[model samples]
Target: MFQLGKTIVSEDIIEKEFVCNLSACKGACCIEGDAGAPLEENEAKILDDIYSKVKPFLRPEGIKAIEQQGTWIKSDFGELETPLINDAECAYVIFDKKGTALCAIEEAYNKGIVDWKKPVSCHLYPVRVKDFSEFASVNYHKWEICDDACTLGKELQVPIYKFVKEALIRKFGQHWYAELEKVAEKNN
Candidate 1:
C-alpha cells in the first residue's frame, strides 16, 4: 500500500485491471448485491431532495421500495445505503430496454434534472473507501461477479486506477489523484 495525502491506497488498485463490461455482466453489481449502494450521510438528504425528480425514471418496484424505506436506510452494520427492493436490487436501479440495470439518479443527472451524480460509492465500484478521523483506506474490491470486467480490462490494457479516474478524483480531489498518477508511473 502507498499513501497519497491522507489516503492509504492498496497496490492492487494499480496492479489490477478492470473495466465494467455491462453486456457480459448485465450490471449484476446493481441487482445481485446483498445490500444497496453505500451512501454518505449527506447523500441521504440528496436522495430525499431529489426523489420527486428521480421517481419518474425509476421502476414501480424501485419507487415503492424508496417510499416504504424512506430515501435511504441503515444497514445491519449501521452504515447508510440506498433502499433495496425485497432486499435485492437497489431502489434507485432502473433498467433499459435490454434489461441492464441503471441508476435512475444518474439518469436524472444526465437529463440535468439533478446536479449530483449517483452516490460516490457506486461511482467508485471495485474501489471501496473506508473513512477514518485521520485518513481513509482505499482498496480494490475483488468480486467474482466482475470477472468479465477484469478480463475485458486486461484485453483493453486499462489499469483499475485509470479506468476509475474521474470517480477517484471526484472522491479524493485532483491533487490526490495527481499524486496517485505519479506513484503509478514510478511503480510501472
Candidate 2:
C-alpha cells in the first residue's frame, strides 16, 4: 500500500485490471449483491430530495422498495445504503433494453434532472473506501462476479486506477490523483 495525501491506497489498485464488461456480466453487481449500494452521509439526503425526479426512471419494484423503506436505509453494520428489493437488487436499479441493470439516479443525472451522479461508492465500484478520523483506506474489491471485467480489462490493458480515474479525482482532489499517477509511474 501507498499513501497519497491522507488516503492509504492498496497496490492492487495499480496492479489489477478491471473494466466493467456489462454484456458479459449483465451488470450482476447491481442485481446480485446481498447489500444495497453504499451511500455517503449526504447521499441519503440527496436521494430523498430527488426521489420524485428519479422515480419515473425506476422499475415498479424499485419504487415500491424506496417508498416502503425510504430512500436509504441503515444496514445492520450501521452503514447507509440504498434500500433493496427482496434483499436482492438495489432499489435504485433500472434495467436497460438489453436487460442490464443500471442506476436510475444516474439516468436522471444524464437527463439533467439531478446534479449528483449516483452515489460515489457506486461510481467507484471495485474500489471500496473506508474513512477514519485521520485518513481513508482505499482498496480494490476482488469479487468473483467481476472476473469477466478483469479479463476484459487485461485484454484492453486498462489498469484499475485508469478505469476509475474520474472517481478517484472526485473522492480525492485532482492533485491527489496526480500524485497517485506519479506513484504508479514509478512503480511501473
Per-residue lDDT of candidate 1, residues 37-143 (tens digit): 98999999998899999999999999888888899999899999988999899988888989899999999999999999999999999899999999999999999
lDDT of 2 by residue, 69-181 (tens): 99999999999999999999999989989999899999999999889998999999999999999999999999999999999999999999999999999989899999989
lDDT of 2: 0.93
TM-score of each: 0.98, 0.98
* Candidate 1 positional error at 80, Å: 0.4
lDDT of 1 at 108: 96
Candidate 1 lDDT score at position 127: 95
State each model's CA lDDT, in order. 0.93, 0.93
Off by over 4 Å in 2: none
